[model samples]
Target: MVPDAILQEDGPLRPNLVTVAHAQYRVRAGALSVVTETVALTKALGRVLAQDVTATRDQPPFKASAMDGYAVRSQDLARRVNPATLKLVGESQAGRAFTGRVSRGQAVRIFTGAAVPAGCDAVVVQENTLAGEGTVTILSDGLKLTRRHVRPTGQDFNCGDVLLKSGERLDPWRLSLVAAAGLDRVTVARRPVIAVLSTGDELVAPGEIPSGDQIFESASHAVMALIKQWGGKPVSLGVGKDTKKSLLRALKTADAELIVTIGGASVGDHDLVKPALAKLGLELSFDGIKVRPGKPTAFGNLKDGRRVLSLPGNPASAFVMAQVLLKAWLETSLGMPPRQDYAHATTTAAIGANGPREAFLRGTCSLSSDGRMQVTPFADQDSSLITVFSRTDALIHLPSGSEAKSPGDLVDILPLDRL
Candidate 1:
């Protein structure tokens, strides 16, 4: 049997009334450093940067025309009391430069993105010019027009400027910027390697019919999907029986920086995970977080500095713990940004709290006719039920010590899809 001291709430961590921020701080402080590698820019999306990316050359690199028009001297157009006739000296297309300069009465036929020729102060759009024998006539007075439709060199960015800072997660748009800055490759933090295991003697794998006392397998695949969604590489460690020896062997052979065990974390006779982890020299960072569907959660670090997170066996509890705890811990360890998008909603019905622990009730949020955020909790919130979570879009956090909430009370909500 596991020692009572290891399973019981002692002095410093007693009361167990921890806020979300406090839990995140503890995980961050204990997170391990992520491995890194250099990958091609095409595969760098969704990966965090390991080093600062600098611009190799100025964007645009030259003064270019913004429209299809004639490049002319602004002073020459201003001096003319009447419409001026100028010769079309040459044409400047993208990627090809015009070698000659423009003189008086000479204008270059330029297209959009073409480099502006020397001595030309403005571009008279082709629409504003009338063509005749060997010359084009400027139609309007051209008073308000200025010299050069030129997009000056380095207008967007200068050379040696930091285009992207270290620790930024690259997305499609960020990749476009890196390509525009002449980068073909990028250095990114290696994906966090995670090992997933499910624990229970009553569970059997799918496709195999269980005996009269056995139930269908649970928690492993669902937890693996969540890990993938959060950008981690998952390795299946299979299911372990509810015994200390089996659990110990699973942890010993798993090759990952992080290990996630599903189920057998509560204070039940069958809860062998806590004892198994302790026997393997795992230091208890904290156990029993003050949250609903996840109150029995456990977090620790192996003697070799790897992380071990023990989540409740129920599918709903496993998912909730992964979202609220595992996501934040992995992101911070890998230098990824914290997800901060949350919506405020008015509760449509009354909600009662259990006790000191904060409860995350599954609910659907929508915009009302008056533009207020409205949230309606699902009828069933049992941790064992997974069907209700499919219909939920947000988790409504109920603060501790609150007995009940009436209609119209504001609640903090975390969106399901975004996280």
Candidate 2:
């Protein structure tokens, strides 16, 4: 295994500057596909399936009614002109089918989801009925000739049909469909566990004002929330002071498949994450990415085959790196597809970029009158400004060699959400 620092050697051709695409490629290449198991359908929401879900039984299972109405033979109703009255035989409710077959001139009072009896080809809602003791008359013209509000068996799905594919995330609405297909459980991927540690000697937890030179702690919890949003279980390891022993102990004790350390990957003397990870026999992939606010980001692998990501102390940079790299890594580990909602949008303001690396800018994306997306960068693009990212819906990627983009220029915008 290669040490974490060995991957960052400055080469004449590669230049040691890591681009967003290259960082993502390296992270994805190390993804270990997690194991999977069957979970009850009720608990399967938000989980990715490990196996294709085939319908065990046909949806609806039988011809059924879709409305609270009267079931009748279309031929019997068609024989009468104007409002046609039919004798009411019996009532049919959901889960209990009307066993008696409907002959000519006969109708069954059926509620929604009730199985349609044999010989019935149409249904008329009860609200359109004019009742007279044993008979109900249709009040609307053409109602007797219309075939309405009747659902056929296997209309949704058939037995053995594929309902959901492997690697697909199941939502509550999708779980309902699985239940409709008579499946009580589903096979889904195990959720990835992530351990987060905040490292800094000058930092103190929130609720406690720094007595001397300490600053209020930030970034770890925020990054943890981002991990949760990406479908990973995040465990906060609290704060680790600037010491190799403390950092090393934290990395060794973490019970997660992925360990994240915030604030100690830089070259400062107090930054001990890199050396601590090195002492534990971790193979470093890269120590820095060629992006602003996050150039000091580091990645490595633990002795036990777990992955470790060390992010910058700057809150904004940490968040940007997490969104750009960690999100993709978690998705790949869970067998999910890459997010491709990135599109070109007209820039509403001029912005500068690093000449050699793509810059991700926080911007608000709005639909223009001409039905095009317009991305406007926040006035303050500083790496420490966390508020700017909160108000934005997408990240505007400014490619290399592009110094500044004027208004109306077409720039690539990656949508923050799947929507």
Candidate 3:
């Protein structure tokens, strides 16, 4: 039986919610292939690793001091009859090791991170020692003498230890780890070049005066930011006017593995993205989905094998779908599997029954009084409301035919990527 909900005028039967989420993974669908490249560690941030990152050398290659004091043999500090004192020999500063060795009744001045001198098994912190002419005295502060205060060789990691596995995105902390691994370069997945095209006649770029009834195009800017955040190189194709020629021209200039089209994807008279690309052999995969604010979203590939993900023009719709879909697609192209981005959380307010389409409601999440994860859906869910999305930290997901949810009811949530 044909569902009356999906019997739209000019598009194919809208796919159900499950198919909408799973079937559109064309980046990993034997069309777009993941590419690998070696990049400098400085330029590797936000790029995915194509190979496992191994530590090139042992951290703290030698026994290192964890405190700034004197390095002495433990027997030297255990003097019972005589005061705990030793003759100061030499100083061991960081990156400058002392040549002479420590013997009984002898100590070497060592700073933090300096290599511990040989024949020394313990460190007496400067706070516990009183400096004299050429010798030092360990004060009887009534403290335990068990603390060696020495970082053993390979304390952090050994040479050839796998620190990062394949498909891990390099963030600042991860980059610092790689930098500390004695590496100047690393092999990472080449960022997929994704082109963003905004199509409309009544839209103008920000900073321009909206002459008559035009509004500023905002979705493409947010999409480009998302592309880079998800490890893809974003190429902006600017705005394509509401004409076949305009869209085709913009589409032709997309030298990218994926083209993300915003707006002009519905059955309306001005919706010409499909028609414009049809002239260039646009193959359709899944045309429309049964989801609010993103029903016009579609996925396909062109004759040249470049994949296209058409999104709605509205900023909220585009941004939400980008979080849900584009994030997965880009990760897959970077050799990572699409993550399960949904989890269950308690709703703080009552929610009415959902319509036929599965809805993703913008919401804010926080720990409640008892530390349970709780979410509150925004009052207005208009697809054009960018302000609502700006404050949204999570998306409360309600499947089609879902019953009204009371306060404290558990619901599915998709957390937005704040980065």
Candidate 4:
């Protein structure tokens, strides 16, 4: 039997004993190993860009009016003339331009987005003008503000200018910007397909009636939901039995960029995940982490280069581990920078010292009477308490070897769900 390699606080670092930081580094290092693909701008939302996108043409392409007004030469307004009245020579509407030039004492009736007529330098907003038959009167000398109500050529972006850098995720606004930049198709990182697998013969499908000794499978679904939320494509691979044969078959058949298995990662006799994976040429990176509620979490790569992360069977443990580890891995694969939402707050209640393993206690985060952020850890921290986990909005992190904390002690908390 292979000895379980656990990372304890006081012990020296071992190759097989992984700290959360070390595991995160491994995931980030391999994140850019995925392939890239070109996608239409219409379908690029939530996809990470694989290349810097530059503007193909200048925005506006030409000096254009920003308001429904008359385009006049600034010199026409500065002339030592009375009332500054200028004849309306022609009209310039959107999509159509006044081909004739505007000489002194002449203005073109232009609408918003209309190209500015040649020889014109500014626009007189209709609000500041009095319209008359064949002529207009400037009320406040709008031309004094240079290029007033005119969007200059390349005002928004210039041709060949880099509008977005590589590794930025495309959102609705970014997509709109890219479209405006004259790109119909964009190159982006291929969305990583993650296969979520739940193990244990004692677990049954969610809608099915469980036997006397069985529990409903849940963590895998939650994992899949999270993957989808994070811009990944999640494929569910159902439940794996306890036997090595079943587990091995499941691992071999999954055609995914990453495989996440829930359950059977500990040292119990029936915990056959490690042994089964070994039989299939699995190279273990870290068999265990130094964190509570997820100490049994394991990560490795298959011989074919697909990464595998195995989580404990308990619902709360599996969910927390996925949020901490799997989320980071997915972000890295998607060409996004690794990020976590952590908030520091004072504890509202006294807390005992943590054990050797780093502890992440589920808790509620709220504002105190003085408007300071505060967190209250629940009394029970059992890994099986799925209900408590569901209601928690934060994970109060207690590092290994931490001493008892008082009510006002500051703590780091990872925000969960919507904050």
Candidate 5:
């Protein structure tokens, strides 16, 4: 039987309260899924690959010399005299190969990366040979005598071989590899456009004079920076006044794959984000995650298939929610696997038992005198304290209903920079 909730045209108007994990799972589904586009190699850095890249041409394309030496036949340097002398025909430098074939008792002066001329199967290093006018002497036949110093054609990779798989981030090393594969461009996933919105009548743009009750709007700026760092293009929609009509008007300009609004998401009388979005045909997935500093966090979808994330109004809360929740959603939307950067560290002080909601406390992470990582959480954990948030290098995560822990207890920490 179809639930009445599902039968509704715009789905549930009320936001469902859920655990943080469940909220994350629902938010990771279709928001900002991978979109592919061709991009020049010069602009491909930091972009995720959308297709399996194959080598267009063989690396090294031909048999090349691996050392600055004389190219000779194995048979000519076989067990003969102590120093076998051969006639030096011509030189083979990189980008210029010796045209003539090397006959018996004849050697070519080949530099590193130079294609080995025909009839030569070995490269005697320059240090292992004596070179004079039109003649060369092989002094070392000490080891096995095959084509040991020649880099065969297609040595690193062969033509048509898959060099990079889809969904791989392009770093400097991978970009170099792509260039070596004779490709001038690559197909990569399009960066998702993220729209950041800050809501509240008390908020004003930064650098503007704030009255006694007004504060500078900040949450959207931080969120935008985070989105850019996480490989998404962010557009700030500025502050939406704390009124249903004003919010609805501001939201009309938010045309993006994911829209993140800061503040006015809770159940307060002035918290009008839910009603505003609900009236605009938003299908509520979940709201009110069970987490500290961000319990009012909400996630849903607009009528046009755009995802909406409503964060807490406080600066610290907004930052933490962005890291813990928005980061995962962005990764999923980009088609990348989830990566947790949590590390274990010993606490330097005692922490009280957690309530029903999970807690993420801002803390300073530093190396102790003994070279072990130590975490010390701040005494004041107020969500509005941006100064405390700035000083902290990591978040100390305590599970729901955890017992009071003393100093030296191991705890999980999520590094601030990783977010």
Candidate 6:
């Protein structure tokens, strides 16, 4: 009999997720062939920044009044018990500054956001002052003559300050910040092209009627949606049959940097993804992971240096692996740091003892009675069940060879789809 190791398709390759993640995804940081483009801020939303954005000018550019009141030289109003009166010089409204400087015993009418007139060190709110025809009296009642009502220049941010760093996603608020920084456009990383392909002749494309032995291809559709959400432009390669020729034809058409092939990664006779890709000179990184529902997940690089991530056929399995590994690739390709959303949550019930493989069980996280976050893993953890996956908001992570966990045991949880 042949030794199992000698007969193994991938030789002695078997690694946990950590080794693969660090070697391929994390260690090789920065970006992959980073192509930058100058896009209008209006259309920059959901795009990754390729360059650090600095402020063109100081925010509030001048010392302005924080309230609508009188801008005065504090010395004009002594700290005596009696209120001191000052002559009205000029008014400073927003966008209209008082050109003349404030002399001794003189006050300027300054509205909110107006620049503080020169030689003025304090602003008295209208509520704390008595307005007159030609003069304003500072009420001694509760008025403290100081710079409290003044907003110093560059209070928010100084000129040349790095408002947004590289690799930041230009969301709504981030776009607003850029606009405030006097930028009409921004330099951002080009969205990586991630081709989502599915395998097997038993899978029929959506919008077509499936035969009695076939089911609609759903994994690719879901993965495409996720890819778009993660800032990758996803293209569909449709369904490839079990034949090596058909699979090779479909694979050759994928001109993307990363091709995520769903299904046909196992050792079954119909499993032809690896064999077909091997014809194209695929160097396998690892044929299997030490994780349930994704043990068949495989990562490899072609002769042309393009990488392929093969996932299981089950929709739930494909989705989990995509979240775990595919997102890391997408982030690094876009020059963004790998997001680690792992958190600790107490289990609501006693979890069963885990086997040899690390498990990511579908579950919901909620606030417990004592205001603590708790996770409840679904009773049925069948990999093929998309219903359970749909209702799940978090993945309850259980390490390999872990003992059965009792209620209230803290377990690592990964929030799903930014939930």
Candidate 1 segments whose C-alpha is farther than 4 A from its true place: 1-17, 79-83, 141-143, 146-149, 211-218, 337-343, 346-354, 369-375, 402-409, 417-419
lDDT of 2 by residue, 1-419 (tens): 11122122233324665777888888888776868878888788788878888888777788889899888888876656678888988878998889998887778899999999888988888888877798888766536455558887888999889988887788778888877777888888888999999998888999987977888888887889888877788999999989888888888899999998898888778888889988878898876887655788878797889999888988878988888888888888888877665789998776654455556778898888899889887767677776777787888876655656678889888777532
| Candidate 5 Cα misplacement greater than 4 A, ranges | 1-16, 78-81, 140-149, 340-353, 363-380, 391-393, 403-410, 415-419
- The runs of at least 3 residues in candidate 3 whose Cα sits more than 4 Å from the true structure, single-residue gaps closed, are 1-18, 24-27, 78-83, 370-372
Cα lDDT of model 6 by residue, 1-419, tens digit: 11122112233335444433443453244236678999988889899999999998999899999999899988767666788788999999999999988888899999999999999988999988898999998888525677778999999899999999999998899899999899999999898888877998899988899999998888898899999998999999999999999999988878888889999988899999999999889987767776766778878788887788898998888998888888777888888876777899999877777766667888898998889999988887778888888799998877766777788889999899853
TM-score of each: 0.87, 0.89, 0.89, 0.86, 0.84, 0.89
> Going through the candidates in order, what is the number of backbone clashes in each?
4, 2, 0, 0, 0, 0
TM-score, candidate 5, is 0.84
Candidate 4 lDDT tens digits, 1-419:
00112112435434566777887777676554657999988888888898999988899799999999899888778844455778999999999999998887899999999999999989888887888999998876454556658899999999999999888888889999998987899999887999988999999998999999999988988899988877789998899999999999998899998899999988899899889888777887778888877878888888888888899999888988888888888888877766767789999877787667777888898899999999998877778888898889999887877777788889999988552
Index of the highest-TM-score prediction: 3
lDDT (CA) for every model shown? 0.80, 0.80, 0.83, 0.84, 0.84, 0.83
Whole-model lDDT, candidate 5? 0.84
lDDT: the better of candidates 1 and 4: 4
Clashing pairs in 3: none
RMSD of 4: 5.0
Taking every candidate in turn, the Cα RMSD to the unseen true structure, in Å, is: 5.5, 5.5, 4.1, 5.0, 7.3, 5.3
lDDT of 2 at 298: 76
